[model samples]
Target: MVSRVLVPMDDSETAGRALRYALDVHSDAEITVYHVVGSPSMMMGSAVGLALEDDIETAATERAKPVFDRAHEVAAEYDTEIETQVGLGHPTRAIVARADDYDAIVMGCHGEHSENITRGFLVGNVAKTVFERSPIPVTTVR
Candidate 1:
């Protein structure tokens, strides 16, 4: 039985769909909504700005609050509650590293930053990497 399920999410519609799918398909399992705050880089991206704060961990959590809030709202729709986790660094690595603790992983096929209109592929690098490298079974929701 899948007693624990991990659902990685971003602020994307597909991520929201993936969470709903997990809730519906594994109604009895404990769900964890995981979000990774990418490490700070010279690019000055969102995560980088957050990581530059005095309390990096706290900053990451604060950044992830909205995503978790949305997840909670989604869970409420199913009359269920879900746990949330925040991690730092590469998303694929963070997710795959934690996958061993869960029975299965469910995530969106792609993420908000991965939409490439000019390119043919829609799958995000993180999702593809996690699907290939995860130690447990993975389900991808469109």
Candidate 2:
């Protein structure tokens, strides 16, 4: 009897599929879509803008908009609305840190940038780490 399900999303096809899977499989549960913005980096990245913003929370929200929009579109297909949350720093840590608040976690097998050699090395496998570290059940969709 899972009453709450968390779906961590990125602007990736597999993330979208995980959202759909959660909606279809956990219809009775309250669904929350989470997007993590990279933490402020000295090198090149979106977080550099976050570091400069006077209102860092607002900046993070703005950065998460595209992914959240896609989540909304997916929810629309099921005639449901989803709550959204934004987090800072690494995806795996952000997601796993929040996992205790929900009954389960649903996410993509890997993120959009996981295929990129450079980012893959830098980010590692977010879903794998989240699955291993999460306090709740984790379901991964392809």
Name the runs in model 1 displaced over 4 angstroms.
Answer: 116-119
Indicate which candidate wins on lDDT.
1
Model 1: lDDT of residue 33: 99
lDDT of 1 by residue, 45-93 (tens): 6766864688888889988999999999999999998999999988999
How many backbone collisions does model 1 have?
A: 0
Q: Which regions of candidate 2 are displaced past 4 Å?
A: 118-124
Measured on C-alpha atoms, candidate 2 has an lDDT of 0.88
Q: On residues 28-113, what C-alpha lDDT tens digit does candidate 2 reach at each position? A: 99999999999877674767887888888899999999999999988999999899999999888889989889999999887878
Compute the lDDT of residue 58 as modeled in candidate 1: 89
Highest TM-score against the true fold, candidate: 1
